[model samples]
Target: MPALKSVTDATFVDEVLLAAGPVLVDFWAPWCRPCRAVSPVVEQFAARNRGKITVVKLNADENRETTGTYGVKTIPTLMLFRSCREVSSIVGAPSRKALEAKLREML
Candidate 1:
């Protein structure tokens, strides 16, 4: 299984922006219920798409620069990036199927 990597403002650029494949970044905070609720889906997606995509989790509370750069005003925001460019985003708690479908489309 592909484990989810924790990303901070310091590593965001190298981990997500410069990655070779599509990146699914989950912008969340520990205190957020919705963020926690959607975490499993993100993890499963990561494991399933292991070789095809890179999955990262960014704590919005701790990563101010990253949260600000992405203009993420909401918790549990999911951004899909390819070649360092954001291609799609799903806000709120999306199901595993929905997220997988999006990743499939990107792949």
Candidate 2:
């Protein structure tokens, strides 16, 4: 199973931005119910798109710089990045199909 990695400010560049492939960054926090609810979906999406995309999660509370830079005002915000540039964003809990479609397009 492909597991969604938890990234911090320390690893943001090496793990997500500078990675070899496209990435889906989930900006979330422990207190967010929607974030918790979509965790499984993101995990499964990561598993299915293992080679084509990378899935990661960042805690908004801990990574203020990244959060503010990305303009993430809500919990459970998902940002799609390629070549170190953000291409798209999805807020809230999206269906697996919806998430996959976005990732697939990016890949």
Candidate 3:
């Protein structure tokens, strides 16, 4: 199963921005309760939709520059990128059903 990949400021450009398929970047922090709450859904989606898109997690605490650049002011923000540009986003912890709905519209 494809797993959720961890990203940092150093690799954000190449890993998410320049990626071929749509990249879902989950901006979160280790200490954020809501961030932890949504992690399982993100992981399952990552494995199930492995070929459809790229799922990555960026720890806002460790990757301050990238988080600031992306305008991620909230924890558990999920941003979708295509062709090096951001196309859509989800802020806060959402239900798996809700997240799936958003993914459908974006994908």
Clashes of each: 0, 0, 0
The local lDDT score (0 to 100) that residue 83 gets in candidate 1 is 87
User: Any residue pairs clashing in model 2, and if so which?
Assistant: none
User: Which pairs clash in the backbone of model 1?
Assistant: none
- How would the candidate models be sorted by TM-score, starting from the highest? 3, 1, 2
- Candidate 3 segments whose C-alpha is farther than 4 A from its true place: 1-3
Pick the winner on TM-score between candidates 2 and 3: 3
Off by over 4 Å in 1: 1-3, 95-97
Scored by lDDT, the top model is 3
lDDT of 3 by residue, 1-107 (tens): 55478989999999999898899999988899989888888887778777998889999989899988888898889999999899899999877788777767766
Lowest-sum lDDT 10-residue window in model 3: 98-107
What's the lDDT for all of these models?
0.85, 0.84, 0.87
TM-score of each: 0.88, 0.87, 0.91
On a 0 to 1 TM-score scale, where does candidate 2 land against the true structure? 0.87
The CA lDDT at 7 in model 1 is: 94
TM-score leader? 3
